[model samples]
Target: MENRQENNLVIKVHESDNVAIVIQAGGLPAGSQLGEGTTLAVPIPQGHKVALTAIAEGEPIVRYGEVIGTALAGIARGDHVNETNVRLPEAPALENMPLATRPAPSAEPLDGYTFEGFRNSDGSVGTKNVLGITTSVQCVAGTTDYVVRRIKNELLPNYPNVDDVVALNHTYGCGVAINAPAAIVPIRTLQNIALNPNFGGEVMVIGLGCEKLQPSTLVSDQPVKIYENSQAADPDANILSLQDESFMGFEEMVDGIMAMAKGHLEKLDRRRRETCPASELIVGMQCGGSDAFSGVTANPAVGFATDLIVRAGGSVMFSEVTEVRDAVHLLTPRAADEQVGQALLQQMQWYDRYLEQGQADRSANPSPGNKRGGLSNVVEKALGSIIKSGNSPIADVIGPGERIRKRGLTFAATPASDFICGTLQLAAGMNLQVFTTGRGTPYGLSMVPVIKVSTNTALSQRWHDIIDLDAGRIATGDASIADVGWELFHMILDIASGRKQAAADRLGLHNDLVLFNPAPVT
Candidate 1:
């Protein structure tokens, strides 16, 4: 397990699968033997699949026990199977899928799992003690950043109890069809993001007075209400409009923002970390830069850890609509009830229509990097991606930016793009996040602590300083899935308790929030 010289070999995901990914570094040369009778007929790149048996053209190239694609050409024994040899397949039909067909999973309460976290005025708990400066529109982003930096330099030391101050800047909030039917997604996303549990329920808004998304209308509350006239009724919501006559100069605007941020920081400074039950953790699971090993190594390990959180009465969220679209049949039956199953379908249908309007389909997924990493198409990617939820019964289907009120595994509808997905999950109240990558990425969210898990040892060693955990040991037989899962479980508690900072947080590597505005930009 220490080195691949003794263990480099092909990895077959399932017994019935005909294609296996090459695990040997730099790939194996032509005529190399991979088990008996499976001789390489051509070069196979690391993490790319090779044909385990001869197959006729148009035959199914199976991986993960499901059809990834059909062989576009006759693939001989040990031939490297890639996009050139495999043709994408149509997605699984969505209608009439089975509902609640599986038995309910055990609802046993796990013991002794707790973390030191900030207790908020609301019932919610926070993993960080930071003042969040949210914007109603993007116009005030520059002013907001100046204010946030100043607060961090001159003001943050005075309020040592507060972690840091951040400007929640984004590309939306103006010059869009805000009245369109599809506009609700981005609007609610902005609203709910301000309400993220990490913010300690301290809502602040900076806006340009003439923006389409009015400051008064962006208040986020529970029960999923949409303002009919885009107006807010919460008088207590803090809003600093830069264009207000109260600010006649640039200095005044910065002063006004700094003044408001200080108030929030003072309140945040008083908050202290206390022992809280693990149930307070609302965790979001996602993947990017995926290679074939993603499903085999990292995702399955995350899945095992997901169940652990659920047993501890914590909530785990798995999203990315297109990534899960092809696996609805496998997932629908695991729903907690018929309604949950229906909710899954409704979200799927909405995405289908959304993509159709653009004349593209799920096939648009599995980007160039994915194919290079041996994912032939979306179907193959879906099979690997869906394993992140483990076997926990889905307790709820959260719409974009909606709040979660229950504890268990939940599905939050979002596109598969890494940044957009993270934004939507943050809006859904994810105080912590676990991200698995195979080809490797430095993706992280600004508002949450993201734990990066690598699928293979190569990536873990290469990006040693950045990746937080390595599930790659399972692939090399150095550790079992359950072993790595428990390791990650404990790591989550450490991160949540502020005993450690994830690499993303340490490097300040964060992407600006990208709202999923399906509405047309006017």
Candidate 2:
């Protein structure tokens, strides 16, 4: 890389912007000049925005050429733009918004992309082959987790083709409003996770026998209890009842579990990766620990790569309802048709009501970490967040945990919380993930490959062991969004083909599954 020390130091996200983010690592100090005469009134931290010119109180602070927030006090040229100076704005009403407002996605379709993936019997392809053991109730989690560890030590070594053994555990079942109208949500989430393509459709359930979420209903979508393991010998064998009388002690319990797990490992060991088209890839896109450069660099590069995947007939999901809520108008118009537009609005409305029911608003978001990183409010974060969808037409919109039947860019409705969002995306059948972080996180999931992209080179350099791509190069003029995007796009194919391991994968860093349970807890 060239000596970019003298490179353009401030990033003005849009030409109409009244503020720009300082890109220098230590930030430009007071008296330092940007361009010719914009002198800093105060030092601005890296990723923090600087006022472009004098602006009156109550005026909109623009970023990405959109109304991200309003200035709470008069801001002068070279002043730092912080959340205290930027007031949060109200969310848009769902009624009568424009529908199908944009023409078909304008990015030319990409072609000839292929990857080596695990093609399943159901026509879906996965990037990894793993044995997943799902717990029907939180009560059995301890026992099941023990079984998973035992399998890893004693059985996994013999199954070279299987990537891992993930215990799909969560805090639902037995307690709380199981029969409530919204209870179906968490149930559906756990059920689908068991069916995630990466698991090779090998559904193994550990039930307490008395939990409301019985294996019968949890695995209702699949052939029930058809696992080759015997129910008579280790009657505690499968359909599950950790309390089954057949289990005399901990040893008997362990034996039953090992019997079931061994069967899964043996079958999974026969699976192999084969060359597959990029269309078979189901990718979930997300961002965490974000900063201003996210919209300008990493996410945009992700957006470009998103377009590449969509054009190749692959499914890409950009989720986090709160993150995209404010910028949704930009999305509805890009919907494939009026139905998609309506569906998009409906989900937004649902989330709006969901928030109101809790007596909260979108303003409650854009966490303290977000504020420190220069996101003035949720609106600005949203504007930057939505760009990950690129300009691709949203072919469909699905509720959390619902599998996407259509390819192209699909919006999966989920809370902005990283763990829950990733879990929902996994249930939606994503075999791969692209996560952009400006502030940075070590977040990863065991079920799929999560490729991390840094918004700035500084973060990439610092966390090179964790971040897979340095999108910050775009901020320093070292690379164009297209340059990094093409690099990332090819990287996705390689990663999807299992030819490369993401930093998280290499370090074995992963987060636990967190189901989206809106029903009342008992």
Candidate 3:
């Protein structure tokens, strides 16, 4: 079990793994000599692999203590373990197992867990205090944007605590049937935006007079002010004036909202390190721009972290139900109840029907980039993707834009589109998101802080600004998955308390919204 360093190359992560990862590059030949007792099994590159022992075909290749795939050919000691000689085993169908048979995790509370959030009038907490400028349709998007642009450049400069002035503009809202199913979709989407935890104080809705959607119809008694385009000679000026008055009069009316925000930041400055119970945390597991290493490195590490969070009584949610495809059996036995399992099955069937009607299969996922990254099949991609959910009981299933009510582990129904799913997840009330990627993406929601994790060291270093954590070390054998998972957990808390800004936030990449278009009915 002794690892000796040679020629600037070192093996750091020594799990009970049959392989060791090369951590640095050196001009070592295939038969290069190492320490007195060691020799090169193969020429290894930094962030690649080396064999610890001879592997036979069909033998399981273990990394991060999970069976990633099996060896395809006989491999000698110190040989590089990669795709040429490795292939994933066919996953077995899920059995009908009872939830009670699964191991029960101990009840533990997250220690000293608290976020400096705005406590809303209705008791919900908000991470950001936004003053939203909303419009009902694309026709009014220009007006809405004009109002927000004026506020951002002119008014918000005075209000230092207001995070940003945002406009909820969309392409849809007109040209679609305004009947039961059609209208309900956008209506619910708008309502979710209005009630999102990001907005604390107030919102101003501006609607074009003749649009299918109306501002008056959407406005409720929820601390919102409305102004129709028909009401003013200059709507932008009126809105600006209203904003000025609102910020001015809020000192007396809102009483302590600003002061509370300021005090919360001060208290948040004290960062005493403490191990909180895992159950107090809720993790949103997600992947985007995935590659082969995704399942092996980042996604599995995220899964291990998900397990830690779940075992500690915290919850985790992973979606993209359509991508589950043939892997539904893997999750069914873990369902909290028969109803939950049935609900998942029903959703899968519905998605299949929808896809078939379009003469397409949802399995036509894994974009061109994914294919180039060494993933060949949707099942292979999904088998790896599901690792992010960790090993937990599937306590519940949630529909699109639905609030996460049940506590334990749940599966949310979100499409494979990252922006749409991410936005919907945020709207579903996830306080934060843990997004893993290999190719990299700059996407974030308005309120929820997305922590971007890289699956490989090269991407992590190349996109350092965007990637918050690097599980690539797992691939290079520099760190264990569990250790990386621990690091990720703390990073979550750091972002939650405003100590860090995910790359998406720093880039101001928050143009995400729920898409509500449906297939046209005959």
Better of 1 and 2 by lDDT: 2
Query: Candidate 3, 418: how far from true, in Å?
Result: 0.8
lDDT tens digits, residue span 1-522, model 3 = 122233335342325556544544332457755442346766765445566678898897664344546788898876777656767455333445333335444445445545455555554555556666556667767656665665566556666666676777766556767664645655666656666655653545555556666664554545333322231322222122123233345332122222222322233232222333334445578898987667667987898777766665666789886556556766776777788887777767666766778797754776877755555456556766887877777888887666676666778877788877776676566667899997777767766678889988888888888788999887666887788988987777677656777788888877547564553523
Candidate 2, residue 101: the lDDT equals: 78
Best by lDDT: 2
Off by over 4 Å in 2: 1-7, 226-238
lDDT of 2 by residue, 139-252 (tens): 988988898889999989988999999888898888788889888789889878877888887768887778888877767766665323246543223455676776778877
* Residue 507 in candidate 1, Cα distance off native in Å: 1.1
Instruction: Rank candidates, lDDT, best first.
Output: 2, 1, 3
| Pick by TM-score: 1 or 2, better one | 2
Query: What are the TM-scores, per candidate, against the unseen true structure?
Result: 0.95, 0.96, 0.73
| Comparison by lDDT, 1 against 3, better one | 1
Stretches of model 1 off by over 4 angstroms after superposition: 1-8, 106-108, 220-237
Each candidate structure's count of clashing pairs:
0, 5, 8
lDDT of 2: 0.86
Clashing pairs in 3: 109-277, 110-276, 110-277, 111-276, 111-277, 279-312, 279-313, 279-314
lDDT for residue 292 in candidate 3, whole number 0-100? 61
